[model samples]
Target: LTVGPPPTPIPNPQVVATDFLEVNREELQRWVRGEPGAFDWSPFIQHVCKIEGRGEPWQEKERRLRGRLRRILPIDVHCADPLGAPLRPPADALLSTFCLEAVSPDRAAFGRALLNVGSMLRPGGHALLLGALGESFYLAGAARLPVVPLDEDDVRGALSDAGFTIRDFRSYAMPPALRTAVDDVQGVFFVHAQKPLEG
Candidate 1:
């Protein structure tokens, strides 16, 4: 879901809906225009679609994604304040990438954010999280943004405390060449977890 407000001011609720869609459409266009192999999002999208029993041809799927992106704006909810945003009923699954790590200043904050995210899920719901592991900072445009360095153990403990059961977890070490190219990120972690059904 695309949470938070649009880049520009929205005069009204209706305008908020429209502006959010426009902003997302522009961002998706920018991503699609990047060099080939710059981002391999298709496979991941396909996998999710397959699991949801909505798989389609690559071209069709891409078109659908573009169409959906242009029409949908999930500005109704924010991770830190899900209830305040009035996200009712909860979601069956959630996917977050590099968000909590970028915004959280420390391990405790990360854990809190994780709990907040878990609260958005229905019981037995799944979550896929990808974040930079052991990263203190990353460059954003011209400014350096602080990141909360978290390890596998920290993530596991946080998920468990958040009422989630670990289903899959993987980490990748930063390659020497890529390590110096951008930030001092030691590696990245990919985690798939589920909220306990009993809870």
Candidate 2:
């Protein structure tokens, strides 16, 4: 978290985050500008610092993060250029958590979504993706959104086809106690992959 901002080695680093929905983008902007009704991310930051056993005060870390966040733009992961317009040169890395599967209706769409989002990064850039494996359909409020059931092989194949070289792939099974009828999420997968040097 203390690393310099992506694609930049300069001292004044900044983060450019994006969301597909205007509402979501606004929410982040609200938080970034400290508007009313903004969520407090202090506890989450504190927890992460505790886990990392870092000596730096969590408040200091939070300040650094807020300072780094300069923009919250809109993005469409299904589009060729997710950001729709040029913001800056390609980023060095991206981190996605439980997004592509939730937005995609099927396996093919999932792969396409990955490729689209990955396009935002420069060649040889890396990605840390955390997503579900097997057993689809997650409950968002009263709505049950369909998810493409994907296993280890499916993820590997999709990454391969997308031109990502998988550095590591880890899976964690759903514990019985946490499993519920609301969502049939069988397991979760975490992958650290890198694109080729030449785009």
Candidate 3:
């Protein structure tokens, strides 16, 4: 089952009403925000500072940016699978992208996981992702996960083998927490690939 605000948040995106799989709000928020994964650390750091100051109530205001991105792009969701395997969705599905993250510094596994996610999408579907390219740092719940950096070339090669056409592959910085200064992080590569309709 799949339903929520439409893939594209438009004039009247309505909350979908479906009864298939469970739609826990907590899980949805985690996926929407990419939590415990690619996230900002500034707020967390600030929160810790307050903890040290004791029981004083502090008003932390969240800013909501109002703007419009003038693009009618396809909406996508990525399931970080190691092997390029197909995932079955209900017929009413609206998402267009599935993905994996195989560019870990280990090189022990290539884009297998990411490829697995891509295999489930319909042809012409798109995806966006953050990959580690030549980066050697990461943190897992206070424990450090050793990472070795992989370059853009490596990412492309894996996606190609998984039957995806490279749409826009680039490098991007991980959230502050992923950086060594904030904690201990190494390096990473970013990519966006698609399954061609003509395939």
Q: Write the per-residue lDDT of candidate 1 for residues 61-89, one digit (tens) a residue.
A: 66555454432334322256644453355
Q: Please, what is the TM-score per model? A: 0.68, 0.90, 0.47
The list of candidate 1 runs beyond 4 A from truth reads 1-57, 67-80
TM-score-better candidate, 1 vs 2: 2
* lDDT (tens digit, per residue) of candidate 3 on 1-199: 1235657534532222111124433344443354675345456545765877864333231111101211121222233431223333311222221112322334435555455556545576665556555545545487655554566676777778778776666566556664554233334555566676763
Candidate 2 per-residue lDDT over residues 33-132, each given as its tens digit? 8777898888999998999996889989888988889888888888877888654778778889988888888899889999888888788888999999
Candidates ranked by lDDT: 2, 1, 3
Cα lDDT of candidate 3 equals 0.45
**What residue pairs are clashing in model 1?**
none
TM-score of 2: 0.90
Pull out the clashing pairs in model 2: none
Off by over 4 Å in 3: 1-105, 172-179, 182-188
State which candidate, 1 or 3, has the greater lDDT: 1
The lDDT for every candidate, in the order shown, is 0.71, 0.86, 0.45
Model 1 poorest 10 in a row by lDDT: 11-20
